[model samples]
Target: MTANRFTFRRLDLQDMAQASRIHRAAFDNSLPWLKGLHTPQEDQWFYENCVFEQCEVWAAFSPDMAGIIAFKTGWIEQLYILPDFQGHGIGSALLRQAQTTFPHLQLWTFQRNIQAQQFYEKHGFIAIGKTDGSGNEEKEPDMLYEWRRAGS
Candidate 1:
């Protein structure tokens, strides 16, 4: 899709379910090893209770919900684009939206997700730290990334 084609806006309660679906699809596609780790119900609950309650969620819609970014303060909790929409600038647009909101941001992605690593790095997020699988529920190694506005 063209970069200007997508509509970006804040998410509402009615959107939590679709956001959960997008997260599951993108997460499983990127990290197949973790597929089925969470039930659809659990994902929905997380979105409604944790994500919606804690962060501000914004989504991209190229006629449909294409991607979402959940962020708060100096951290980005989630950013997922539908697999069908991957690599089409939707993700970058959402990420840039988040960057524009916060002067600094931090997020974590599984170590094995090379595409995500490269994507974040390209957007100026640097690897600040890493950890073995033990620290997270998935028990998978992860890399911590941070991005800050120039002179901030």
Candidate 2:
């Protein structure tokens, strides 16, 4: 699908590197305190082995990867937009792939990311639960957000 200058497509193995770059850049940008939490190799490995192998990965490319989302039947593992792509609809377009596919969806966002919290809230996702700085590699407190389609 195409929207504006962006086109959406299933992420292929060749996209592992770009997807990892977007995830790491956005993750560190949104959580500066957790910057460099993983090396480039680790990020690439995770994207290759975990995300690509597990989820239905997709991306929005304005001739280049502007955003990416990794999602399964009921969970969104990752959603990131390149810094330059923020404020555009790339994130929302990638998110809609999941929201439109499943009747419901859930994902985690760090508690400190107010912008991310607001973005999800604006898109009809509600904070369904929370956790302390545990159970995660970053040990950052996070909230679980859920979205259910209207009448679903």
Candidate 3:
């Protein structure tokens, strides 16, 4: 499908269910350590209250919601797309939108998620730090990536 098929927009409270579904599905599928970590209901509740509350969220919709990217201050808190929509430009679209909005942005990705690392790197993000599974709930090794505007 062409990029024209997708619409990007800021999301609100009404979009909670759809956005949470993408978030839960993407993480649950990609992260081995996250399997069974939380019930679907628990995840939804957390997404709405914790994740949604903390960030400004934008979604890419292929008539229906296909993906979302959420960020706050200088941090990209979340980005997720449905598995069926993975290979398309939905993720790139969302990240481009986020990058345009935040001249400098940073995010954390699990060390095991190589696809994510590669994607971010392709978009000009560079690893700035690494952790030994101490600060996050998942208790897994993670890396921090940062993107800054040229000459900034």
Candidate 4:
């Protein structure tokens, strides 16, 4: 799909189900530990009450919800796109939105998700640290990436 066809907008509570589906589908395909670990209902609840309430969320819709990104202060908490929507510029668009919102931003990605690591790096995020996963629910190896404005 053409990038121009996608509309970006603030995500509301009503978009939780679609957002969670994209989150689950993307993670299931990219992260081995998350596969089949949570049901749609569980994801919906967590994203709606726990995540959405705490962050500023933006979504890309090709007339239909395609992907979402959530950020709080200077941290990008979550970014996900549907499998079918991958490589279509939705992820980059979401990342650009985050950059526009914050002069500097930070995020964590599973160490095993090489594609994601590359994506963030390509977008100017640098790997500033690595962790053994002690602080995350998955308890899997992860890395922290950060991006700063050109002069900041």
Top candidate on TM-score is: 1
| Candidate 1 RMSD to the real structure | 0.7
TM-score of each: 0.98, 0.96, 0.94, 0.95
lDDT values of the candidates?
A: 0.93, 0.91, 0.88, 0.90
What ordering of candidates by TM-score runs from best to worst? 1, 2, 4, 3
Candidate 1 clash pair list: none
The sequence of per-residue lDDT tens digits that candidate 1 reaches over residues 27-145 is 99989989999999999999999999999999999899988999999999999998889888988998888899999999999899999999999999999999997989999999999
lDDT of 4 by residue, 42-140 (tens): 999988998889998889998888889999889999999888889999999988888988899999998999999999999999999999999988888
Tens-place lDDT per residue, model 2, 1-152, is: 43567989999987999999999999888889999999999999999998999999999888888889999999999999988889888888889999989999999999999999999999999999999968998899999999999999
Q: What lDDT is reached at residue 111 by model 4?
A: 93
lDDT of 2: 0.91
lDDT of 2 at 22: 92
RMSD of each: 0.7, 1.8, 1.3, 1.1
lDDT of 2 at 97: 91
Give the TM-score (vs. native) of candidate 4: 0.95
Task: Please provide, for model 3 over 1-152, each residue's C-alpha lDDT reduced to its tens digit, 9 standing for 90 to 100.
Answer: 75568999999987887888888888888885678888878877877898789988999888999889999879999999888888788888888887888899999999999999999999999999999989999899999999998888
Off by over 4 Å in 3: none
Candidate 2's error at 143, in angstroms?
Answer: 0.2
User: Count of backbone clashes for each model?
Assistant: 0, 0, 0, 0
